[model samples]
Target: MKNKILIWGGSLLAFLLVVIVVLFIFRSRVLQYTIERVITKVENKYPADLNIGNAEFVDWNSVVLNDISFVPHGLDTLFTTDSVYATVSFRSIFKGRIVFKRLEVSDGYLTARKNGDVNNFDFLFKKSETAQPVDTTKGRNYGTLLNRVIETAFDNVPDQVDFKNLNASYKSPNRMIDVRMPFLRIDDGYVESQVSILADSIQNNLRVRGTIDPGDYNINASLYAFDEKGIRLPYVKKKFEGEVAFDTLHLSLTNKRYRNEKLTVRGRAMVNNLILNHAKLNDEDILVKESAIDYVVTLGQNLFEVDSATEVRVNSAKANIYAAYQNKPSKIYDLGVKTEWMPANDFFGSLPAGLFENLDGIKASGELKYKMKFHVNMDSLDYLVFNSDLDASKDFKIQQWGNTNLQKINGSFVHTVYEYGKPVRTFTVGPSNAFYAPINQISRHLRNAILTAEDAGYYSHKGFHEEAFRQAIIKNLEEGEFARGGSTISMQLVKNVFLSRKKTVARKVEEAIIVWMIENLDLVSKNRMFEVYLNIIEWGPDVYGAKDASRFYFGKEPSELNLNEAIFLTSIIPSPKRYRSSFDSYGNLRSHKGYYYRLIGGIMRRRGLITQEEFENLYPNVKLYGRARDLIVTAPDAAEEDTTEFELETIDLLDF
Candidate 1:
């Protein structure tokens, strides 16, 4: 029995050794056949030519490939490599998977260029061309989708990489970017890459290094300028029309967890010496010294949330932020931010330079804190909730003003009235300026009329009304357009007196900040702000202020307007340039304006701004006696004039 066992074992060993020897002798041919099969399959699907000059197995686990290239049909070369050497796992091949343990490339070039709308990379996304549009109404699990993508990406990346003399480029329209990488490597999950970039003829270099994890969500990376000029982004300027630069940017993803159909991700991102320049953001370049955010996000079945534990820091100020959006059943949103009470000096110093241009260099005393919350249900627009409050301690005070002096509205100053975003007139708000109307000199009917129509709570509230802003948001959402503004009497005053009239996000922000300062700090009194607002705003094409508007329409002074005349003047505030739409060929007010008169007059009467007899006697038979009378257009037919009235009623009556 012993002899039989020994003979059988020797026979099995001899057979296995012979099989190994045969495979080694034909390894090059086997590798070549495998490469050919892969090339044929890829070419069949992509409509491209894939070629390899030579392929062979240098060792049991290593493959050497030379002169590899790929090109789409009738297009420039997409990729080319002089040589590639990869160490692959042989056992994974038996399981129908090719895993590369190490990969090295020599002299590689990849190009992605776009001319107009046509691009060479479209072929790589060929499958997407034939794909159907997504049905957004359908239910989806956000966690499941994101997890699958992360798993697929992490599973495929090689553990080690060594690439030298690699070049890549992209061009679109008049813009182009060229990247030259001298060295790129990954070893034991550590990555290092130094790349020189030329974008739109501007040159820069960048350095990147990080500790990465493939099987887990663990990464810490730092990216910054290779030289002393800081890191300027390559593709952002053209894409966003904004120049962005930073000294250093770091990101760390420390943890990921899943439970109860929710995937939680914890991470932190940091930046130093960040600069942003854009028209919509600000007219000047905004600079921040340091900023960071430690965030925890929960991606759920159909919702995404950044938990309240998330902390954000900018310079010396810090805040806790929470935001969420739910798409299931109906779209709902929520956002909140709460900040710690910090020194007012630090708060003012932390303001971004260009974003808060009016507040820059402002000096203050005491402590300040801020809190805000917003909630909305798209399906129920009326139920939207919002509140924002920025409070200072009792000892808080502004010691010095910044670039803009908030107290200027209290007295005479150069007020520029803009027409179509160009300065049509620059004059003083006091008696020295032509057609300037003081609060007391303006007609009581006109004052009451403008205030009641533009902002009913202009006297009782601060510079901003939370309810008004909330309703503004709801109204805009219902109309699916920006058709309303929540500007108060004070906001309107600040916008006209201290800020440019250009419609931009940055201007709006500056206007808001200035309004708060003047109104809350009593830098400008309510009556004075209202006086300046009435004097500087445009009431018609080239007709500005209450004094000019009255003269232009009725050939009368500011104090001579009656109730009907004031109401008529107020109604045109929405489309002042199109004010002729409300008049007939004879310069008589449109008939539908009677409804507007009754609506505004009744409100004034109820609020005790006018008597009941004044409200009851109100009429829309306003007549023009000035140059505006000759500007009215002749009606094609008197019987069809009601169509014009109907069309005119579609506009929302406003004064600011």
Candidate 2:
């Protein structure tokens, strides 16, 4: 048996030696056949033609290709290079896969063109809708294209890659750009590149340096983008370090899925002299002298936290913020913001041009200070609660109301407070005679009840309620509809008095701007703003203002309104035109509305607006009309002129 084993081993060894010698003698022919097969496969799979001058194995471990050119099937050459070469390790092939030591490309040019939505190069990879039937084996696998390429070429990352003298050009319907990279070097997982880019009207220079560790799943990168004049663009001059991973990966925004992963980034960002294109601020772009921020942000599986956020301000206000968002069973966010004293006018001046048409028109000067703590559930924003305060060192004044300004607002405003399709307002507010009751003159009970129902933070916050708005957005997401009216009394007043009844984003922004002016500029006292709101708001159909609403509903003066009457009045403000729905045919309050009335009454009582005895004695069965003789005209029709057109297109649908 031992002799037989020796003979068999000797024969195997001799056969292996012969096979190796044969392979070595025909190595060049084998390389030629392999290169031809690769070229044929590429041509068959892509809508493109390939050209090659020569392919040679420069040494034992290197392959070089010369005069390579590629063109889309119907278009000009997309890319051309004088030479391309790759050096690999032969020993690593015995372990498992080939490992590249170095790759170099010389004197390459790439061009891309787009006409409308279609591009010349897109046809090379993107299949045509009416293309012929494809053989699965011959077609490229797009779904795993990235993985396949990475697996094949980067099974073991290359030690270094160098590209020299590369020029890239892109042409689109709206713009043309040229990019030149004199040299690009990637070594040991670190990349360093410098590029000069020229566009139709802009010239930019960019330097990018980054390190990537795929094994550790981490990356650190910095980019600097500046114009020829050395001005940094907003997206330029940024440094980011983080770890990211995606689950159920998809490139589409709507279908992408994200898994909870911890990402922590610490960075300082800057944008010198950012310009915004807008028509309203003026015909020219709005120039922001400076905008920057330094922050530390951490995101966990179901939570996001910003531990420090400091806005860099040179000629504007200084603001700092700390915020966190968590979604364990439900989503919640807590944010604290503070702003130091700064020029109020400068703050507005920094906003979009024409967004606030006249800055100097409202003569105001003061240093402002603001502080706020906000917390809310994203699930139901209407139930949000918060505390905030905004004050100035000295009260500023608006001496003049421009033609497009808020003070020029003068007219008898009529609101069809009820009925969704009813005309809610008419400009021809005749005989602006609705009795204006001061905050002190109005019943404390009514004031407290209204606050409890409408906005509990009315006196404490500025024109905006962040928590409520955030909650509204969260609840909107859940319901697939906007079911909350996250407006504060100040916002409502700005919407009613100074702006049109149009429900639009522009209107909302303008309303907030006006409110900021009113609050920050000290244009009016909080009590005065509230009084004006009560006087101008539509309490019911044709019911304009609180005094009219009081007389129409309770047959009493605003100051004489009791707790129950006050709650009922506040309850209908959300849907005054639909107020009749809360009452039965006999004019008795509905059971559900009665429940809401009692709820508001209880809150008012708990808030000390009404005594415990009054709360217990408060009856929810208050009828809208006591008797036929007691009924008074709540909404008196206003006189309309020829130009005054009243059309009801659903104003307020928020449920309080």
Candidate 3:
């Protein structure tokens, strides 16, 4: 039995040696045949053409190739190379596999082109007929899958790599970017690259140096721009109509561990001398000297979370943020931001441009702390939680104003209203303007009616009405759109006085901050703010202020406006430009409006702004006596002048 076993083992060893020798001797022939089969399969599967000069194994572990190119059908060449050489693992070759250990590429180019919405590189991601549709409703085990993918990708990277004289270009209808890398090398996972980039009208030189450890799953890299001019981001200018640049960007992945079905990744991301600009943001560039986020990310079964321990620093401000998103059981989102007690100036300076325009360049004293918490379940939006506040210390005080002064509303000042970025009307907010009326000069009924129609809590609230804002957020989230506004009487006044007419989230935030400053700092009296709101708000196509509104509707002075006329004017305040729509073809107010009129009048009567007799006799009837009379159409199409949605929205938003 022992002798038979020895003979069988010897025969098996000799046969294996003979097989290895045969594979090595005819490896070129086998390679040529394999290449032909692969080319045929790829050509049949995709809209791409492949061209090659020749491929052969030059030595025991090296393969050299010439001219290779790949072009999308009916488009430019996506990639082309003059010559390529690689040294692969000898064991892998013997195991019928080719794993690259070293690589060198000389003279190559890659390009992409996009015209309008058409692009030449989109086919790469096109789904095939056999591909299965993604089912996002089901929970995914991302931690395990992602860890495996990372390990596989890193393991595949060549230990040594070199690229000489490569050019990459991207052209679009709006912009073009050309990149030239004279030399890029990686030896023992130490990387260095010199890149020259031209982005449309801008040119920049950059250097990237890094160390990568595939086995340890660690990487540290830094990007530096020559001349300290910052590396202007490409394509963003054309895509978003903005310029984003950074002087130095440092990134580090310190550790990643997978345990107990959870993956934790810790990293540091930083940028210095960041510059941002856009017309909607600010006329001048918004600059940040330094910003960084030291983050710890956790991924588990159907869950992704940014640990609360993560610290974020922007300029002189510091804060901690925690966020989590879950897709199992029910789609849920949670976010929290807790800011340290920072200097008032530092806090104001950290506010993003456009979002906090009113606080820009504002000088302040004392300390400010802010905190916000938000959570929502997609299945039950009504239960969403949102709480955000600024806790200013007692020592807090505004030392100087920013873009616009809140105190300017206290006294007579020229107020200009803009429409579509153009100044449409310029009028004084005080008595100097003929149309401007004081709080006493304005009719009590008109003032009361406007208050009831817009914000009944205008007198009690300092600047914001939390209930209204909460409802606005809930409704907006439910509809997945900004279909409603939570502006208070104070907010409206500040928007008209200190901000633009453009309706945007940024504008709303700025308006809110300005209103808060004005109310909290006691910069303007409630009476004066209400008086100014009555003086500057748009009343009709070309009319403004209460005096004009009273005259336009009833040909009466501000004090002469009656209850019914005041209600009609107040109702139109929500949609002044479309005020004509309030009346039907015969030029009479719609009957449905009477219901809201009585509802608001009831609130007014209870507040003692109007007598019981006035409430009982109230009617939604008013005659247009000024130029507004010509705006009413005798033969109006209901759809052309429909204001039902706008009216319902305004009435529902009324604080009363």
lDDT of 1 at 311: 99
Residue 258 of model 1 has an lDDT of 79
Question: Which is the winner by TM-score between candidate 2 and candidate 3?
Answer: 3
How big is the positional error of residue 141 in model 1, measured in Å on the Cα after superposition? 4.2
User: Whole-model lDDT, candidate 1?
Assistant: 0.80
Ranking by TM-score: 1, 3, 2
Model 2 is weakest, by summed lDDT over 10 consecutive residues, at 245-254
Between prediction 1 and prediction 3, which has the larger TM-score?
A: 1
Q: Residue 546, candidate 2: how far off, in angstroms?
A: 3.2
Measured against the true structure, the TM-scores of the candidates, in listed sequence, are 0.76, 0.49, 0.74
Task: Give the candidates in order of lDDT, highest first.
Answer: 3, 1, 2
Best by lDDT: 3
lDDT of 2 at 530: 78
> Clash number for model 2?
13
The lDDT for every candidate, in the order shown, is 0.80, 0.62, 0.81
Once fitted onto the true fold, the runs of candidate 2 whose alpha carbons sit more than 4 angstroms away are: 1-341, 356-366, 369-391, 394-452, 455-488, 499-522, 525-527, 547-566, 602-618, 621-656
Q: Which runs of model 1 end up more than 4 angstroms from their true locations?
A: 1-142, 156-161, 166-180, 196-204, 227-247, 277-279, 630-656
Candidate 2 on 1-656: residue-level lDDT in tens? 99999999999999978866665565556656666766787787777878888977777768787998888877768889999887756654333334457889898898898878767676544444575554554333332333233233333344588889888998887668788998877788787777787764446677767764545433455556543454223222122211111111111111111222244555555555455442322333445555556666665545667774545453365678789887766778888888877675665545544444444244446666778787778776666666666666655555455445554333334433323324545433334454655556677777787788788998887678877776676666578776887889988887766555555454566676678777765667787777767777777656777777777776678898877677778888888877666654444555676567657766665566667677666765543433311332233341221122222122121322
Ten consecutive residues with minimal summed lDDT in candidate 1?
A: 644-653
